[model samples]
Target: MRSADRVDLVLRDVALPHLEDGHGGAGAGYRVDVAVHDGRVVAVEASLSLRGVCEYDGHGAALLPGLHDHHLHLLATAAVAGSVDCSDATTLDELGARLRAGTPRAGWVRAVGHHEARVGRLTRDLLDALMGPERATTPVRVRDHSGALWVLNSAALAALGPLPDTPDVERDGSGRVSGRLWRLDHELGARVGRTAPDLAALGAELARLGITGVTDATPDLPRATVDLLDGARRTGALPQRVHLLGAATAAVPETLTVGPAKIHLRDHDLPTVDELAARVTAHHRTGRPVAVHCLGVEALVLTLAALEDAGHVPGDRIEHASVVPPALLPRLRATRVQVVTQPGFLSARGDDLVRDVGAAEQAWLWPWAGLRAAGIPVCGASDAPHGPLSPWQVIAAAADRRTPSGRVVGAGERVPASLALGGYLTHPEAPAGSVRRIVPGAPADLVLLHGPLEAALAGVPANPVRLTVVAGRVVHDAG
Candidate 1:
């Protein structure tokens, strides 16, 4: 072979997904050599006679497109690394012990993944007692697992001086601040003055999980956050390509792709149908689709009605669609609104949901197969910091629908492992659309599993990836 034909990299004897049979089944895939050059796949055949600048013996491992997390909060995920994780704390004492053990950062103690069901409701008095007198004056804030509320201690609340006269700031029976703040992220962040976490560690972790791309679903991103993300990408601190769902289209830098306009809605503060319709129309008029946050039935219904009034755009989506009753399946299908859901929620918070929403309503929570059967485009996401971050863990949850207690949350809603995996292989811009494949012209972003697809996905290994490549460069190599 001519020297010109030499490729940048080559993987010999790797199995590629075949159309003849379903993934992981007998005789489902065929083995061949894949060559990459200039950030794209250059050749695939029985044997590659040409030499490569770099080569690896796959030993018949399955090669697939790198995973993409359709929805997540990158900054929050990074920041949570430093916060006290209370997700595993079942009792108030356990939660308090964890919080007290965590060293304060800048004179503040930040905690995350707190569940009200496990520890009951939190208040300033309760936090003060939990922290003890030694740390009574230290500012403390704990984020609910739902990512909807912040439970601040009296010290933390006092640190802000005066509170805004808004319903979001809850008050106790005596008309004093209750220490519960709802949807006040901007206000809380401004007063707390916490700096952004480094993205390098988060990016490396993602590459290790074989995630080559991601869609940051943080709504209404400030310009500073956007600049931080762009700088991270440019400096290679963040190796994954990102799609921003909240950045203004015109203001977005060329390095990052703009996604749908994010509309955050709460059932308690829902807008009128006309008001939501107008907002959707405004976004559509600007040639931008909308991704609405709909975790409950009421919010989902409101979103569907707004879409109907404003006319659904091609890229319109419903984030979380967490609760979808049977009656709304037809309406959801008719709207052509894609759903980007988090199956990991089942594994992370299934028991709490079972207790809160009841066993009868379990079928309606994160209905993956049901939505797909109804002809509604559906995809899986992690919703990290709120849910589990590993895509493999998410895929396992999707396939088994099992909670931490080993109980299946939605038995009928379980999907095939291949289908669950396919959700992450889709284009970020069209998450519920076609799955990207490994072809000669495709980008060289790929993952090489440690074994055959069947074995790798059998129980969803903790880390099945042996190698990860992005833009023709090896980002991760287990060897």
Candidate 2:
């Protein structure tokens, strides 16, 4: 390597996807030599004479901008990776067997993905009986995938002790605690603390899949959680850039830089218009964006109304406009709300959605194309433990709208794979309207795939990421 032309890194003979014509056809891209220096692309030419400290032979592989997940609960997803998975248990016996097999940590036996229909109703007495008399004293907790309900044994409830007499706590016909806790995750979590899996290792795993950025959309992020993420990033444990959306109220840190104030709304249980207006107005006054979680038509409508009344601020977002109808498109566009949607929901829970959502609202679920056509900016997300975390799976779902059962949910809303991939490239510097591309002066956050651009966009290949570079540094290299 010659010192006169030295650069940090260079990739020779890489196929660069045409910025606009990505996924157009078999030969939509051209080959170029790219040089990186000081965390940015310094050169891209048909051929380059520069010497690099590290030179990689792309061998004609496609090189593109790195991916991002616009919405995900980082801590929760990491926790799910280590939690006992009961998603496959089809009967009470099976679930009980799994529970019996679980090793309690800190006197708590926790499990996730509990399905009542398949395993029958779970109750305090039922859980106690399942544990058998010898181990009945152990505290046990099991949460369903929906994140709405939790079933706890008597010991578990006692551990938390003398809970507030709130509607979220359930009781049986005999006035005994039913062991079913509703929407009290934050409360329960406070007691359990941060017993999640290794967050640094989880971030590294994401890097391997070419994810260079993510928004941690965990509402009401506690100080401990925030500090944990900050420490990880400082120590280089986290390679992806993180943006955060907090709950209605949270401490805003300078470094973490709170991105939005998250408002969680449920169907028919929404706050009054005046209440919503007040919150939105206050957040705007404080220079924080508002991100509302609206999954049903009713929730979406109410949320849109609130945003309209408050007057849409620049960075305002709608997290999941899950069931947006054509009638609401004009209203939504007028609000100028940016949507962070979960196309991965179709792949993860499409079957249940088909059964639950009425025919009138069927096509409205995950209306990315419709939103895009309405001039509303849309970003794709993997709501993580709630949805699959794989960016490729999310892209496929957006492009195909196909469920695991092979049923297409909303064929009319299907988008070209390239367009879906572009959704992940929206960054603070690039914003919504700005074009995302790989060229000189752009940040060298990129992924090198083992195929041509057209092939990748037709459908993302499993295990396609050969290398991931973030800010000119190779974060993951399986090359």
* Candidate 2 per-residue lDDT over residues 1-479, each given as its tens digit: 34378999999999987655321223458899999999999998877899899999999999988887888888778877667789878888888888888888767888988877657889888999988887888889998766668999988988888776656778766767899887677788888663755788888888988898888887777777788887777777887887888633355454455677887774534688888888899999988778888888888878888888899778889888888989999999999878888888898878767776788788888888888888888868888878888888888899899987999998989987777777776674222444357889999998998887776766647658888998899999996
Top-scoring candidate (lDDT): 1
Off by over 4 Å in 2: 1-3, 21-27, 117-121, 171-176, 247-255, 428-435
Per-prediction backbone clash count? 0, 1
Runs with alpha carbons beyond 4 Å of true place in candidate 1: 1-4, 19-27, 173-175
104-186: candidate 1 lDDT, tens digit per residue: 88778999999998888998889989999988889999999999989999899889888987778888778899898898886
TM-score (C-alpha, index-matched) for candidate 1:
0.96
* C-alpha lDDT score of every prediction, in listed order: 0.88, 0.80
